[model samples]
Target: MTEHQALRIRRFSTDSAPVGERFDAWAAHSTYCDMVTTYRSDLPFDAHRDNVSIGPLILAGRTWRHPDPSLAYDAKRTPARIRADQRDFHSFSLQICGTAALRSDASTAVKRAGDLYLLDFARPFERVITPGSEISLSVPRDWLPADTGKLHGASLTRGVGSLFGDYLMSLYNTLPQLTRHDVPHIVRATTELLKASLHPELDTLAAAQTPIRDLLLQRIRRYIDDHLLQPDLTPGSICRDVGLSRAMLYRLFESAGGVMREIRQKRLYRVHQVLSSPDRPEERIRDVAWRHGFTDEKYFYRIFKAEFGHTPRETVEQVRHRRETGTN
Candidate 1:
């Protein structure tokens, strides 16, 4: 409710505590607050703040930012009752960042750009990560498919083909999970993809399909269409806004062919739409094309004819004749 409201619950608080120098605990809970908390993990079990966010899912992440830090944090601890406690949630992690040593229930893995580690939140996890490294979680009991629930007992390693994995990693590296206005929808869409990616049968994943992907593609395209006049709507800007890699970004048009091809096609489509509109006859075709990111008038005509099989002049003439006869 409050702007930038922070709710922090801490097992170790140096601010009001008598001792702040070093904290040593076998295990403890964290103080959660803010859109994200960036933190440190060390023996005597230390904690730091995180800039990463937890949207809809119960996400807790840690990364090293300072020197003199070879950090390790245990999300689940070895308890006295048994080897591990029963975890109800499914957890996943991505080294969506720098380097690190990662440990799952089965073995230790190194962190890389595409490295993914899956685990059971019901069981304990120990991690030794480096600065700029990333950690993420997906609550499968609460998020994943029913049949894929079998994955919770197994250890998660990288190289799995799932959009949930990609989407989770994508959010970590690209989009800010929190926004002044858009956090809700961002969290919703992200979790949808995240849950879908966990299914053994990727077919169950709604995000990987043609329709939803196409829907998002259309949203992005329409956004581009509305903002074509902006000079800075280049690939980098589009990647940032659309939360896609420059390479994967081109795939948005793979459904049609290629990105630039789609851009030109859409531009031509808009140009024709304007030129053919009988009510907008006063608007110049050159003005319409330029408004859609066409810089050269002559080049626009060439591409238009190549695409539409007619020149801009001819298209306008056809529109004029159609308007005169009410047959357009």
Candidate 2:
């Protein structure tokens, strides 16, 4: 496929249209136009949108420049409209330079600049947008973690929300430069980041347990064991190879502190076993530790003592004494 076919891009602007037809033209191009009743302002309407489709995700940058402060537009998605359209996706809008208000059956929120708000297209909602600019991302509902319904119509202004907003902005800025080969990785990373931002808690295994989760966990553990000696082994690599989302992978290992912690402990255990063995008697302790992915001698000693309650040298000495004394 061609580059354009790989990453579809669409641009809509009111600047090229007559002032009288701007609102109609802009609304006609909107993804929500079919499912929403848009109320146009009597004043002149001005808006622009650039949309890029990367895999299953749609990222759009929008800006509205009204000549008067009172010039605003609003849209309402009623139950009838929702039933008619049957759109089931989540839209995360990060306000960059304007303010907006959303009201839904669940809650009401006022989103200011630097705030991010979520909208579920399947739900009944109404939103009023003033003169402002924003980046909006539409993702499949199933891409998000469970229990994200609580985020509907809610605005996130700080913490992980802020970081997610920054990420959305950066992604928007670079969308034009992204290629088809980059789509899958981008989609996975974006989905994982969105899951982490929206749901920061470590979900209990009991809550997320399933046959697939169990199978994935087993596969991940096996992969880690097989690659334990590889110094470059990381969560990212594991996720890519094991076909698991970062959020789900972390949740699977939450009880063990985390995947990285598990990897570290497993590596340390292998090092301990090697150090305690009578074979390869000429191998230096540092070499044994380094072979198992630990490069810093001091850190190796520290963690080795912390894990096994004794220094590496002490363990080696005990093994030597056992060999000399013919002890088991």
Candidate 3:
């Protein structure tokens, strides 16, 4: 990875502190130290956290070790604390080793190993955390859909939930090798997985299963863009090449106003780009349209006008004028 894409990892541990002062040091280093009150057991407190910031999301791998397994720590976010802090964010924690009981006004559940649960920081909540390791993801409230409020304190361990939990673990494991170019795609996939796993009623879930559906959609779009200049780039060809059934292809692009419509729009965009380029001044608009798989000149002109609010000739003229005047 380039220097700019290099992963920035921050490690916080109580290992350097004296045994008597370890718990306080751990609390001081916590990300939510001010938002919650932490109570530790009498046993020696030992904790370690590694954090990586990926765009707007923060992914952390945390471990708490104590001599007593029954009670590691109790952290509570009270109403007064919430009001005083005014923090609004969502936390998705995947328990990797042990169990924890989470409670909030929206829901209450115990999350065991391999289980994932969500916490909304805007709401008051309590967590009786046992000695364990977990992968935690912190997402800004605005980054999630409004309906995600229902997921607060909800334990997810089945079906799509399991898939999401596994994805998080995999992402955490591979974070060290990822580049900056991968950040946007990771964020998009994470959002899609979260939406699919947390909200089943969403229309986007009808296309396919989470992560698989997300990957397929990306592949389809890339394939379409790569072959936009081909004349026989129809849904049948896409289905054949992308290994998707015709029904599944249609379902995948349903939210995009159907596959054929997407093709037409993409062609129109290509034609518009050609028309608006000063270097392509000698190329006729019809030839540009045909090159982009728009065979019917009249139909192309109509749709082009409808899409851009101007005729193809107008776009060329505007480009010519801007080139001559040396102005954008």
For residues 193-216, write the lDDT of model 3, one tens digit per residue. 777777656574653255556656
Which residue pairs does candidate 3 place in steric collision? none
Against the reference, the lDDT scores of all candidates come to: 0.56, 0.77, 0.79
What's the distance in Å from true for residue 272, model 3?
A: 41
Every candidate's CA RMSD: 7.9, 11.8, 11.8
Listed in order, each prediction's TM-score against the native is 0.57, 0.57, 0.59
Candidate 2 residue-wise lDDT, 166-199, digit = tens = 6687567656545676676667667766766776
| Candidate number with greatest lDDT | 3
Q: Which residue pairs overlap in candidate 2's backbone?
A: none
Which lDDT value does model 3 have at 294? 81
For candidate 3, give the lDDT: 0.79
- Tell me the deviation in Å of residue 134 in model 3: 1.1
Worst 10 residues of 2 by lDDT: 204-213
